[model samples]
Target chain A: DAGITQSPRHKVTETGTPVTLRCHQTENHRYMYWYRQDPGHGLRLIHYSYGVKDTDKGEVSDGYSVSRSKTEDFLLTLESATSSQTSVYFCAISESFRAEGYTFGSGTRLTVV
Target chain B: AQSVTQLDSQVPVFEEAPVELRCNYSSSVSVYLFWYVQYPNQGLQLLLKYLSGSTLVKGINGFEAEFNKSQTSFHLRKPSVHISDTAEYFCAVWNTGNQFYFGTGTSLTVIP
Candidate 1:
């Protein structure tokens, strides 16, 4: 099992509210990623962090922001949650080039009503 | 840029039967490939990956995949399967510079 954990295994909130998901890794990996999994759409990347404060947008990065102030912590925040934003969120960590394999967290199921 | 395709969305087979999950990818340059499995209500776990070297890469749980450079395919195969093998399997590819891509995933069900 990976040393990664995502906070709030399940959450429910109203539309237009702000939601923040936290991913913590005990391995101290350098690369962290956020992805959302939906039926038919599979899993799509939202954002990733290479280092502290170094982040970039992913294929489906709109309305979402990520921050990595420390090596073991990566936070993903939805500025304003919408019904469309409801999905399972997964946090993953990998070493440079992904030589070994990525470590994934248990995932957070977010529901926006 | 890289993209992965898992042709079979669902595959049902009897326990002890052989099975294969097809995955194809597109990339302009040489790339890395991976397979991950997710059980019901569980996190995704790494099954196998192909970074370099041999085209046939073996993973945990008696699973293996072949990376065909010419066909741009990385199909996963197992000679025999168990009921515990039922799960969602995903195929992923990564290009140079760390850009990664994943397929829609295939759900495998093993019957008793």
Candidate 2:
């Protein structure tokens, strides 16, 4: 919460438009993640980046894309916003892959109509 | 792959009463367990985590959890809960991979 920040705390976009949410961290942690929180489903991982150029898809990554061109920033993009894509998105960072837990951002509320 | 299960979706208890929120996980290998609390319209805060060594771990807000390896359970408990404890609790498991699997969450309501 102190080192990581998510921009566009709240956003409403029209359907079929592209949307990108930014997650920037001052901690310079090696691992960053994007997750969506929904009722009954909890938090589902959408994507993760391990390094500046390395990334991977998570369980619910079909409609989402992620990019990490720099060590301090990770971005999640919606190719085309859909009504079903409306959800609260959280960005988290961890210092290690196996030993440490995550520090999460405050989260962004997104709505597509 | 690892998976976390929260059996109780909602639990109601009187203030100052003891409460336990159940959490179970499945994994072939050893994993790191954690409990996170999310208040309404807020990001998750780490309640506690069990990395290794101790089976009993204490966290913020007088919350604690025990790791039962035999049952693969990490349940959160508080002897005396306050109204401020009302929030959604999530159990998470981090496997050998870079991913963290979270449970569906248990909503705890502290009644007056």
**Each prediction's whole-model lDDT (CA):** 0.91, 0.93
Give the per-residue lDDT of model 1 (tens digit) for A1-113: 46999998999999999999999999978999999999877789999998999999999999999999999999999999999999999999987646355788999999999
Model 2, range B1-112, lDDT digits (tens) per residue? Answer: 6778999999999999999999999874778899999998888999999988989999999999999999999999999999999999999988777568899999999999
The CAPRI classification for model 2 reads as: medium
Stretches of candidate 2 off by over 4 Å are none
Clashes by residue pair, model 2: none
Tell me how many residue pairs clash in candidate 2: 0
Using lDDT, give the best candidate's number: 2
TM-score of 1: 0.96
